[model samples]
Target: MKQQIKHQYAGQYSQLSTKDFNYIKDHLSWELLAAKKCAHYAQESQDPQLATLINQIGLMHQRHYNTLLQYVNPQSVQD
Candidate 1:
């Protein structure tokens, strides 16, 4: 499957901070990659739950990204 909207937004989220930004950036990248891999494996292995779990992890990364963004810019979070 092609990349999702959340994956496409990774770059925008990557620019939020200098400290730990790279780590977050790398993590998001990895999560998307992992999600794809999990999807492939789930398809090959016929395990729907694995794909579901991978998507859940992807959502967690998005939530984490949003939390960090709010932390880095509280004003933006309020508005």
Candidate 2:
């Protein structure tokens, strides 16, 4: 039989419902993908200012990704 993994979220409740968990997982993926896409476009950009702006946008997405990751697995998160 396949095993199921459980998650505990921070705040008032320790556990998330299946729907909420799935949403978080999906959101996490979206954030990571956005970050990667931004980075790729930034590298492909020839304009210095545009590249910088894209890089900054990528950083924002990356930060959101990481924060969501921490919530999903706080134990693995490093200081």
Best by TM-score: 2
Which tens-of-lDDT digit does each residue in 1-79 have in candidate 2? 4334566656433566677778899999999999999999999999999999999999999999989998888776677
lDDT of 1 at 78: 43
TM-score of 2: 0.82
Compute the lDDT of residue 36 as modeled in candidate 2.
97
Q: What is the TM-score of each candidate against the true structure?
A: 0.41, 0.82
Rate residue 13 of model 1 by lDDT: 41
Q: What Cα-based lDDT does every candidate model obtain?
A: 0.54, 0.86
Instruction: Residues 34-66, candidate 1: write the lDDT tens digits.
Output: 656655665565557876776576566556656
Query: Number of clashes in every candidate structure?
Result: 0, 0
